[model samples]
Each structure stands twice: as C-alpha cells, then as structure tokens.
Target: MSTSPPAGPTPEEMRDMLRAMTLIRRFEERASEEYMAGRIGGFLHLAIGEEAAIVGTVSALRPDDPLTSTYREHGQALARGTDPRAIMAELLGRATGICGGRGGSMHLMDRERSFYGGYGIVGGSVPLALGLAWASHYRGDDRVSVTMFGEGAANQGVVSECFNMAGLWDLPIVFLILNNQYGMGTPVERAAAVEDFYPRATAYDIESWKVDGMDVLAVRAAISEAARLAREERRPACVELLAYRYKGHSMSDPDTVRDAAEKERWKARDPLVTFERVLLGEGIMDASAIAQMQAEVDQVVDDATEFAKGSPEVPVDQLADQVYAQPWNDDPRGSALVNP
Candidate 1:
C-alpha cells in the first residue's frame, strides 16, 4: 500500500520519529554485536527494517494503553517508553533487568509503561491482550490494548479465537499484523491463504485497514484512526502493515532462502531512509538535524550497552525462581519433613 501525503509532521515530531527510529536501529545493531560477543544469551530477533511499524504505531497509542508484542519487540517496548537501560539490562539477563533477569530478550516486561510483555510463543499474547481490553472495558476505562504479531502468526487459530471474542465483547483492542513478508525462512505466500491480512479480520466483523509499513507517517495515521475508532465507538480493529525485515528471521538464519535481489529491493525501502527523505523533502528537517539525531541515538545505545555490561546477573542458585509460584507447604497435620 502506498502512503498518502498529509501536510507532513511538524519539525519536532519528525525529529522525534527520527530519533526513535535511529535509537531502535542502533540498539539492535549493538545487540547483534553483543550477541556475537557472547554478552547476550538466547534468541535475539532484530527488527532492523520495520522501525516505522513499531515507532509509528507506538506514537499513536495513549500513555495508559497496554501493549503485547511478539518476540521481535525491542523497538516496540522502547517506543512505548520502557527505559533503554533497563531493556538492555534485560537482554543481558541482569538482576536489575525489567523482569529481574528472569525474562530475557524474548520476555521483556514493563507494566509501569503499560507494556505487557514480549511473548516468545507465536500468537500467544493475542488472547492476553483481549483479556486486558476486556478488563479495561469492565472498569469503564478508555484505555485500549494493542497486540502486535507477524504475518506468520496470522494463521494461528488462537488469533482468530481472540478476534472472535473481542468482536463479540466489543472490546477496545487493535490487532496489528506486521507483515514482513517472511516467516523465518518461509515467505508469507507459503503460509497464509490470503496475503492481505486486514481482510481476514472482516470475518470476525471487525474494522480493518492496511498501510505502508515503510512509511512511519502512514502507519501512525492508520493506527491513530484505528485507536480512535476503538475508544470512541467500542469497536475492534485490525491493521496489516506491509513491511520487510532486512535481517534473517532470527540472528541464526542467514536469510539465504530469499533471493539476493529481493533483499536488496526491500533494503532500498528501509523505513528510516524513506521517512528521512519525506521529512527533508517536506522541509521539516535537513541533513544537519538528521546527523544530530543519529549521534544522539548512537550515544543512547552506547550507554545502554555499558549499563548492560555493568549490570549483575541473577544468582545461579535462584535460577528456578518464578518458574511457578513458590510451592506451598500445606501440611496442617505437622508431618515430619520427608525428602522422597
């Protein structure tokens, strides 16, 4: 989908978007470096090319709105106002991390920012987000819940189930499908019956739209409209943002499955570059301002890395903590201790 040209964002907003995108880019780049250096453990999914989808959708959300995202969620959490240092620390599994070193890269959480979590399982958070929206509605709150997942997850039966429940309950929720073309090594065409995901939401009688994910402004406008509809009219909405991931599905995949020319084609439409061109062309920002924004983002990422490096790891003996609620000793008869 092509983006419609509006009057263009104010210089300040444009600059903010630039800073956010650059921060995400630099953060992911540093994360890759850290992962390779053995500083970060576990799966690391970098949203190198989908910055617009994260930054733009997050910019449209209310401060009190809750967010549930897939594993590729560093950008979303940062855009939702999670502290960069804390997020970096979480990636490093530090005791001072967001989840206190328990939930690493795939499980960052910050309830204070209304960021629910970064779920590892595909489509696992869809129902959770719906339940959050239901809670908000039951409390007579206007806050909405935004659930983000990749196109690969669109086929999950859980997603459709959540959509049905949200529609039936008239919940204030936005299901954002970040269609980045490929689901790991398999492309969307190979998995989804219909590549146009927005239309799939119509089966549940929800309002839906598709936007150009490479254009931050377009994504922001579409999501803003969707959020407004959900809040004011008590309607559920879905949006499919057409985007592409420059890196492999995870750090492990070399992205060899797709053609080299296709990768180059998507790279040419990199969200950061596309947005910068629009801003500069519209006279909202110039090269100097962009350079400054890049520098600021670089410093933020560098500081986050240093913070992660210095943060302490969880104690080895406490590794099993929080796996399940602490086992209760329900022996009311005062039975003697037994180590069977």
Candidate 2:
C-alpha cells in the first residue's frame, strides 16, 4: 500500500521515538544476558533489529486503543505501556509477573493498558483482534484494534478469514505485518507466493501500505495514516514493514542459516542506530543527550533484572489454578450439581 503527502516529524516527536527505540534495544539486550544466566525460562524471541516497527506503530496508537500480537511480542507489550519490571518478572515466571507467573515470555498480557495477551499459536490472534474491533464498532467507540504478526502468519488461513471479515464489515482494525525477511529458517520467497505482503490486502478490498521497518519515521507516518483511516472512515488497513531480526526464531536456535555477509548488511541498518543517526542529523539530540538516554534505559533494565531475580516463584500447589477459568468442583457446595 502507498500514500502521499509526507511531512517530517517535530523535534520532540523524533526524540521520543529515539528514546522508545533505545529502551526496547536495551531491554532486549538485558533479557538476553539474563536468559544466558538461566533467569528466564521457556522460549524467548527477541526483536533486536525490528525496534522501529514496534515503537513506530505503537507511538501512532491512542492510549486506549487495544493491541494484540504474536508470540514474539516483548516489544509490543513494552510499547503498549507495560512496565519493564513486570515484563521481566513475567519472563522469569515470578508470582509478581503480569499473568501472575502463568503466562511467560510468549503470553504476556496487561489488560489495564489494553494490551491483549500475546497468542502462542500461529495466526491465532488475528481473529481475536477482529473481534475486539467489532466490539469497538458495536459500542460506537472510535477505538482501533491493532494486531501485529510476522510474515509467516500471512499464509495462515485464519488471517485471510479475519481479513475478509474486517474488510467486509469495515471494522476499525489495522493489520501491522512485521515482515522481518525470514520466518524461522524459511525466507519469504520460499514460503510465500508474492514477496510484497501488503498487496495481499488488495484481494480483500482493504487499503494497504508498505513501509521500511528500519526507518522509524516512515513506519510512524504509515501507521498514523492507516490508523486515522481506520478510526474516522471505519476501514480496515494493512501495513507491511520490511525489516529483519538479528536473532534466531527463538533463543535456542543459532541463527546460522543465513549468510554471515547478509546478517552483517542488516546489522548495519539497525533501527536503533538508524534512529539515533536521524536524531543527531536533525539536531533533535546530541551525543551527550543520547548517551544519557541510553544510561537511563540501561538502569531501568538493570533494575528490572534485579526485580525479577528477587521475585518469588509461584507455589507448586497453585499449578492448576489458572489453567481453567471456573473453580474446580472440589468444593462441597458445588458437588451436588455434578452430572456424575
């Protein structure tokens, strides 16, 4: 998808974008360090090089707007205003975590900030986001529901169904596609028919746009426009952000499938570095200011790591507590109603 009428962001907005990207970068770096130290359990996916897409799309949304994302969602949760400490705690599976030690790295949820739980199943959250948009529409609210997923999810049948319904109903939904070059070990060319995932929206008669995910300003502009269309025009739009992940599909993989030269090329375009350069070029932030910002973010992540480490683990007896919503019939008052 494409749009015109481009304008540069103000100095303050540029600085804020840089700060947000910095926080994400530092947080992920810390998470990696802690994971290696055996603090974080379960599978962990890091959004190392895709900082711009996460911060930019999130910066465009209203605070009350709901966001749903795939399993690689630490950046999404942080961008949606979940506390770093809480996210770190959740990753460590501590009792003070976001989901109270139940939903770990892949399933962080903070309903207070309108961040819906990150779905582990591929393409599962697409329809869930559609339902959220439907609810917003039915209640006559101007809220837009944004759903983030990888390029791999584009081929999922459920995604197409959600797209069809969102377009047909004119639902206020924005499908943010973070096309980070590779889906696990498979490249887009190998897994998908068309490399340009944005045009897939054309099949459903929805508006779409493609942006350079490495450029924070470009992502912000594209998402801002798409979100405005979704809210005011009650339309569904898709944004395809071309980016790459520096890490493997998960923390366990070595990410050695790609050529060393190709990895180096993408590393040179790191979103955090790109945004910092943009800020310096625009005179929005000096080297000292940037250093100070980095220091603050580093401190925050350090504190978060300490908090997660000090947090107590969930008791063994409560393992089955949150598995099901309703209380078990072990209570005598409810025994009489059992069919058996």
Candidate 3:
C-alpha cells in the first residue's frame, strides 16, 4: 500500500504564507512610491522580488531566535511580525518608528521580535549573529541565530572570520546568503572567482545547502533543516538562496545596467504569481478568495502609509536619548552637548 503523498500545509497556513508574501510586495511597492515623493529620506533598498526568501526563512525560525540582516531588510522585519505602521514610520523618520526614528531605513531593530538589526555595513550584521549564537551556546540556550547577507558580503573578511569561529566552536547559527545574482550592479560572475557560495562554507567545515529563493516551500524546507541542525547539533550551517531583485541597488540608481530580457525571464517566475497559481491549481484557494486576500493586504499597506504620514517627526533634542554611555558635562570641548 502506498502512503498518501506527504500532507501539505493546512489551507489556513498556505493562505497565511501567500498573504505574507503579498503584504511584502505591496509594502515595498508603496515604499518606493513614498521615497520618490520625498516622504522617505536616506538610502532606500527594496527587496521587491525576494519575498519568498525573506518570509520562508523567517517562518522556519522560532520566535525567540535572534536575527540580523543587511541593509535590504524591511522584508525581514515584516516577516518577523513587526507592525507595518511602525516600520513605515521608521522609514519616514517619525518618532513612532520602531527605533524611535533614530535608525531610519538602514537600521531597524525590534528587540521584542529578536530582530537585532539591519546593518548598513555590507557584512556588519554577520558577526553580530555570530555573537548572539556564541551567547546562546555559552548560556546553554537552544536559540539558533540567523543572519541574512548578500553574496557581495560573502567575500567580506569579517564574514569569513565568523564562519571560521562558528565552525571551530560549533556555534549554533545559520548564515543565509541571499544571492540575488548581483552585488549592487555587478553580476556575481564578475565579483568572485568561485561564485557558488555554499561550497565555500566547507572551507570552514560547516554544512551547507542551496535553495531556490523564488520557491517559498523550498526555502522553508531547506532553512528548517538547517536551523534544526544548528540548534540541535549546536553547530554552524549555511544556505545560499538563489534570488533576483527587480529594482536597482537603491532608489538612486537608474537601474540601467541589467538587460531587459534577463529581467523578464526572472519576472516570468515571480514568486507571488507562481505561488498564487499553486494556491489556485491545488484548490487551496479560489480566484475570489485570492482576490479578497489581495484586497486585505492592500488595505494593510495603505493604513501603514497613512500612519507614517501622520506620525510626528523625531525631535532633534532627543538625539542622545538612546545612547548607552553618557559623557561629562563640564568639559570645555562641548562634551556637554553629548551629556545634555
């Protein structure tokens, strides 16, 4: 007798995943619009096409697991259940932001969600993840730290150091390389002598794998296993997600370098569209149901935008409020400005 094909996610779970991806897509689109309109300041990096990789990896994780990511990480915060309004406020530099508007787009953190931050430096967050893992290992806690960085950052000396330390100490962590086929405008083939990222983990004696970043299920499966190996075995693991970004490196780039035909090929496999097809063809949801879901996601994004617009700007006087160390007020050299 043949066992029935392994059960898939429940209808509710499937819908949640699809809805999460939709929310990210719409949120990023609206963010781009707001940036262009000058409502959002500073560098803005959009992950419009990497929702599957973001949501899938986050979904596979435990709530208490600490996470770190590169500058392109609004999707990570969203997937970790940070309120969209707060995130939008952060981007808009309003006091209601998650970081009280101090961090802006490149530095978002929600301690409650265990999302440490989205570091501005290329591989800055990787070592932070390693530190968290080391803490967990030292404390005998079962938390597995996860870090997401670009393939460009994969070459960073700090990242290699973290890999070596993790392997040598058997730290519980997962290093997720979001290989979007480009390091900014430069293609992967041009950036590195050995382009395949997962294999490089072997140099540090860490187990590794690669997953289709466009396929949510595949990403979830791979990361779930990687997370398990890290947490249970108390060792390091790595995964390279093959994905593509539809936009330029940042809002400022004209995005002229990539070929139109290459973009079209990736768009044809758009994560949201492919997943929608799966939901429909598999009878998990009907067109009307999917339409309702889309409408809801749109409203969520719209509400977020309005909340951001209405929020108050961060006061300049409170600039030093979050700093942990206070300097002397009596110094003639203006240490008073920091102390005050």
Candidate 4:
C-alpha cells in the first residue's frame, strides 16, 4: 500500500491527469446533487474518492483494450473517455442516453471505447472480460482485458472459477480489485477470510501486487507495468488498488456519524488536493492555473447536467426493445432463432 510511484509524470502529463481527476470529482458531486433533487432515479453510486485509481489505471491502457467495471463506475467511464452527456442522460434514464436509457448508471457502455459495461452484479462481468482476453489471445491481438470489482467480489465462487480459467489458458487479463475497506457497511475484515486479497491470485500462479490507489502516478506505474506484462507476456495479473469512497455505497445508504468521521480521515489526503499540492510543490501549476482548471471542469459538469435535462425520455412503448439482440433478418419475429 505504501509502494513509491515510478518516476513522476512530466509537467504536462501531470496537468492532464489533474484536469481529468478534477472532471471526475466535479461530475460525481453534480451527479449527487441531481440524484437528491430527483433528476436521476434508481441506485446512484458515486466514485468521488476513487478517481485516482480509475483514472490512473485507465490512462495506462491502449484505446482498443477491452475493460469491464463494477457499478460504481461513473469515474471509470469518464476517465476512459465516455461521453459525459451520454452518461448523464443514461443516469436520467432518457432515450438519448447510452444503452438508450435501458442500462442506467450501472450499465453505461460504449463498444467504440472498449468500455464493455457498468455491470450491476458484484462479479458478473468477470467472465465477459475474460472472454475478451481470450479473444485477444485467440486472434493473436495481444490486447489485455481489465476487469474491476470490489473487495467483496473476491469472495465469489465465480470469481475464483474465472481465476482458474485465466491461469489455465494464460489469458491476457488483469483483475483490478478496488479495496475500499467496506462492502456496503460490512468491513472487509468481517467479510474476507484474508484481509490481504492479492495473495488469492497466487493460487492460480497469476502475478499480483498492491498499489497506492490515491496516488495517480503510483497507480499508473503499477497498473501500467501489470498491463505491459499481460500484453507482452500473454499472462494474467491482479492489482489491489487501496482506495476509499467518501460517499455511502449508494443514494439509499443512510449517512451515519461513523461514516462522516471516516470520510474526514480519508479526505485529509483527498486525491485531487494531494495531487494539486504535488503540482504546486513542484511548481507545475500555480494557484490561479489550478483554480482555472477547476472552473473549466465545473462548466463541463454543468453542461452535461443541462444536456441530460434536455434529452428525451425513453418511450414506454419501446420498453420491449433492446431486451434481446436483434436477429440476422429485418424481422426479428421471422428469424428461426427468435421464433424458436
């Protein structure tokens, strides 16, 4: 958890990361406001604190490499280049949204970006990501598949099964375990038999390590190295990103005294603030430049909010659409696979 970052990013690279992390933070804050105001519905999970983990790892990927994520993925999507307006509209359940408003916050996806999903199930998407890695291996493409899940998911039998398959096939995959301490109020210590989760991968002989998830450079260094090994070596790896979420598990989880105190302790090392200090301490950015970057990020989130509000809602009659994959022929009803 305390490993040092590889050589720091250049000034411009640091500035870009600062801007991206700022965008994710601002977007989550605005999304929280919208959810409370009833502009968004259903379960709304925020990644206000884990931006560095999502952003840093994603920044290290190739554009075509496939990736899947857990429900708390607004930050992941934004960091990996998903359209903000589409993501916001999806949360609002509008027709203009990604997945045509069908997937909502937990299913934002874009095949073009290789972001396979915002999976709602705890570890449901692991096999899908593994399949992608297999596809790369099969085609000799060498693209690594990244699948992220919470610490609680590490306990799933299906997760273990997939680990077996990954090792058995020598698949180019990376399991990104985001250890935020609590799995919906259940502390990891209470849930996991082993507090240190990476060792679980050793059972399958996959490479594994832990990284300081709050530090973008460190997360990048560790994840990038893992990805490189996965890509070049055609093997699987695991990374335990030590991070914390400042908000509740979802909009429905009531805030408590203990939760508030925990947030403060973690906020003292807020990823954005910490990174900004590094920028300032190193003279990469002055106060004014930092403020201007934040101001710009605020505008981006504000614009996305307005776009979601203006987007059209999905029609009730079309509810049955997108329920199943369309058949080969023009008429799905006439296709043998569909008719059968």
Candidate 5:
C-alpha cells in the first residue's frame, strides 16, 4: 500500500490549510491578550492577518524540509506543527518550553520538527538557510531549505550576497519575503530601492515570482512550484508574498497604528474569511462544518493557554544553563569551561 497526493492539493488539503490558518489566528489573538495581561515578556510580533501566507508556504514544504524564519514566527511555528501548548509555554519562559525557556517567543527552535531558530536579527537567517541547503546538497539528501524574512530584511546587503551564492551554487533554498507593506515603522516603498522583490532574484539569475499572499491556495501553488524547481531542477528561487499585518510591528509600538481606511482595505481580503467563503461556495464544506472547525480551534487554543498559565517558570539556579555546550554545574572544571 502506497500513499501519495494527487497532482495538486485536494479538498481535504484545502480544509486542512484553512484549519491551520484559523488556528494561528486564534492563537495570535489569544497571545495578544496574554501579552497585554502581563503573561508574556520581551518583544512580541503577531501575524494576525498573514496566516494564509505562513500556513500555505509551510504546507508546501516536505516533512524533512528545514525552515528558518524571522522574529514574527508564532504563526510559522504552529504551521510547522509545533505543539501550541509548548509554544505558549516557551513564550511564558517556562522550564518545560521547547528550548527550555531560554529561547522565549522569538527563538522557537524545535530540532525534532526541523524548525530552526526564529532569528531576532533582520536578514541574519538568510545565509544560514543557504548553508543548510548547501549542506543538504552536499549530503545528497535532496531536502530543501526555506528562509522567510520580512520586507525590511530584504534591503540588507548580506541578503543580496546570500542570493548570489544560492544562485551560483544552485542550492535548494527558497527565499520567501513576507511583504506586509510596512517594515517595522517604515514602509517598504520608502526603505527599499526595488519594491518588486520577487523579480529581484533575476539579478542573480534565480527563478522568481510574486504571490498573492491573501490567497492561501495561490500562495501554496506558487511555493509548490518553487520547491519543484529546487527539488527536480536543482535551482534556487524567491517569492514575495504581498500581505498586510493587522497589528503594529510589535506590542510596544504605540504610534505604529495605521489609518482606519488603509487597515480596512487589507482586512477586506482577510485570508481566513476568503478561504471560508470559497469552501462554502464550492460546497466542499457546509456552514455547520466551518462553525465546528472554528469551535475546535477555540478549544485547542484555550487548552494551550491554560497549559502555559499553569506551567512552571524557569528556576533561578538554571538561568545560566544551555548558555554553553556544557551544563552549568557546581564543579570548578565546568565553571572554567563555560567561562573560557
């Protein structure tokens, strides 16, 4: 007995994508509430309206694929199938977190799931993704590496350099630019010389295309094509997902709120709503099924929140643990090794 998907995604696949996107939306909304209530610390970025791009892109990748991402990674984490409870606990800096609470929200590293670090620095993960792809190529593993960054990081010179190398070596890496219009406080139009980020890959002779990030199926199809070019053709490429962020760059940006008209314009194409309408219109799922899906997602998110709330915080004595390769023990040798 063999199991392989048909030519393209099926009805069930679309439904699954919808479920994942909805899950991320609910999780982020709850996370925002938790952040306001003082349950989470440090910088917090939400992908409230960019769920489709995240879920669709991740679903396009294979199980063995490795992914590196920017600080706006809560949605990516869920899309990659990281336990929502563990992710919440990590945000709370609990001892039982995915990275033992040291990584916090921005550094959700799950080795088992092959989701690498959620890099805090803009454009920092690009070269790392290239390296991962190169390593996989060297080992003949045939796995791809996907590096996702915001439009702000696209301007970094290091990203261009990485682009050159990825194309030159024909590494199997897909550079995904999540263009939410505004990069932090500055709009991308004012920041980058080239607004057509996808075609910019042509400068390095890499295949590229722009994707309507508001549509999950379109985004998934674009990424699936990119992955095919990498897997079968042994090439590298780029994709610019044109979506909008529903929240400020971070929770601390009080002045980052956008004008109501602009906000409503983007919200009009809300990925979650559009996907629901498509499914209902096609008769793939009835209204009751969609409602049931929403109810199930709410329960999952509620359970995750309750789990994180009751989880234990990292102990004071273990604060210095995992800072070095060796454990922080009372022994002099361990102390010297860590210090040295």
Candidate 6:
C-alpha cells in the first residue's frame, strides 16, 4: 500500500504566509512610489509577482541557516525577518538603515538574522553561500546555506564551480534558482540552452526539484524537502522555482519586451489573488479577514516609509569607515590616512 501525501500547512501557518506575502507586496509598491518621488536613489528591482517563491523558501529555513540572495532581494530580506523600517531606511540612505546607509537596494545585509547579503553581481552569492556551507561542514554543524539566484545567473561559471565543489564535498547547501521567465528583457528560452534548470545539478550528483512558484504552499513544501536533504543528510540540492515578475527588470525599463497577453495570463494566477481564494475555500480566512490584512499591511508600509524619512542621514565623517574589514591607521609605512 502507498502512503498518503504529506499534510498541508495548518490554519495559523496559512494565515501567516498570506500576511507575509501581502506585506511584501505593499512594501514593494510603496518602495516604487518612493523611488519615483526621488527619495530612493540608484537602481531598484521589484519582485512584485514572486512573493510566494521568496516567502516559501525563506520560511522553510532554520533561524541559524545562512542565506544569500541576488540583487532583487527586498522580498527575501523581508521574509527573513529584517525590519521593514530598516529596509526602507536603507533604501532611503538613512543611518539607521540595515547596512548603515552604505549598501542600498542591491546590497542589504543582516548578519544577526543570518541573511548574508543581496549581492549586486550576478551569481556572486553562490560562492559566498558555498563558503558558509563549508564553514558549517567544517565546524560539524548542521546549519544549511541557501543561495538564491535567477535563471540568468545560472550560466555564470562560478556557479558551476560551486556546484562541483558542493557535490564533491557533500556540502550542506541549497541552490534556489528563481526562474522568473526573463533575465532583464531576454527570455530564459533565448538565453539558456536548457530551460529546465534543476537538471543541471544532476551532473554533480546533487538532488533537484522543480515547483510551482505561483503557489505558496507548493513552494514551501518543495523547499522544505530540499532543505531537509541538505541539513539532515549533509548533501547539496537544487530547486528551480518557476515564477513571474509583474514589473520591468528595473524601474528604468519600459517593460515593453514581453507580450501583453502573456502578462495578463500570468496575472490571472497571481499568487496573492489565487492564495486568497485558497484561504477562503479552505475556510481559513474570509473576505473581511483578507481586507483587514491588506489594510494592516498598508499601514505597516506607510509607517516604514515615515520611519525611513525621519531617520538621520549617515554622517560624512563615517564615509570611509567600513571600506576595509579590519581597521588600519595612517603610518609612514602604510598608505594615506582614512578617517572614521
């Protein structure tokens, strides 16, 4: 006799997942407003449509598990429990920002939260995650390292190198490929010879899984299993999450590359909208509950924006402080002076 399928998330867990997704949506929307209003500078990438993939993957990880992310990582950081005010402050270049206003949109880090960072370079987080996993393996700890990148970064040579080493040493790590269809205007089909990314890890003897990233529960389940394989068995795994982004690659793009029909088709299955139906159908939440949650999320985003606006700017004297990991003083034998 065959065993039954695993159970789904409980009512409380479902409610939390929906709330988290709503928060990310509202935060990104407000962030776009800030950027347009000239408050947030530099390039901004919004994950308007991939909330399920982010929240699902992050929710599956342990508190101590280290995770790295690509540049489009506001959702990842938020899902990892970074305060919304701090994230907004970082975007606004405030001293209270997560990175002390040094690293902005593409480079948020919270070491205390085990969110390694959001790297600007494509595939940059892979090697860092590998190093984190290696450290855990060396220390005989079970903490897993999760590195998330897009389909575009999958082609990076460094990523393949990490895959080889991870398989060779059986490092406890999970490589999550957020295949959102387009890598800055170029479709994955046009860029990648193999559109199905999970199979790439098989060459290294690493386990792999593909999941419906539009469904939060499905993403959570798939990532949960992948993380378990890494943590319990001390092996490497890969998960390819097929999701979509509703906005342009960056705020600068006109988003004219993709066909309008394709976008509408995807929007019909919007994670938030579809999940709301699921919640209602399962009797986990009602229309009033969803409206209430949306209102609360909006208020949270508004408060975060105000907090960021009110936070102090980084002092000019502290500009060169964190340039080098270790402090260095001016000396005849050394280089020029760098004040703190």
**True-structure RMSD, every candidate:** 3.9, 3.0, 3.4, 3.6, 4.1, 3.1
TM-score of 2: 0.94
Displacement of residue 285 (Cα, Å) in model 1 is: 2.1
Q: Give the TM-score of candidate 3.
A: 0.94
Q: Give one digit per residue, the lDDT tens place, for model 4 in 1-340.
A: 2243445467998898899999998998989899999988889998888988988888888878898998998887887888898999999999988789988999999998999998888889898998999999999997999998999988888889989999999999999999988888888889988898898887898889888889888888888888887988788999999999888889888846245767888988899899999999999999999999999889889999999999988887675477655433445458636564
**Per-residue C-alpha lDDT of model 6 across residues 142-256, encoded as one tens digit per residue:** 9999999999999999999999999999999999999998999999999999899999998999998788999998888888888888988788999999999999999999999
TM-score of every prediction relative to native = 0.93, 0.94, 0.94, 0.92, 0.94, 0.94
Candidate 6, residue 33: CA error in Å? 0.3
Q: Give the lowest summed-lDDT range of ten residues in model 5.
A: 1-10
Which is superior by lDDT, 4 or 5? 5
- Give the higher-TM-score candidate: 1 or 6: 6
Cα error of candidate 6 at position 112, Å = 1.1
Better of 4 and 6 by lDDT: 6
Q: Which stretches of candidate 1 lie over 4 Å from their true place?
A: 1-9, 327-340
Clashes of each: 0, 2, 0, 0, 0, 0
- Model 5 regions lying over 4 Å from their true place: 1-6, 255-257, 325-340
Candidate 2 lDDT trough over 10 residues, lowest sum:
331-340
lDDT tens digits, residue span 218-321, model 5: 88888888888888788997989999998888888873457789999999999999999999998888999999999999999999999989999988888778
Task: Evaluate residue 339 in candidate 3 and report its C-alpha lDDT on the 0 to 100 scale.
Answer: 55
Candidate rank order under lDDT: 6, 3, 2, 1, 5, 4
Q: What is candidate 3's CA lDDT for residue 293?
A: 88
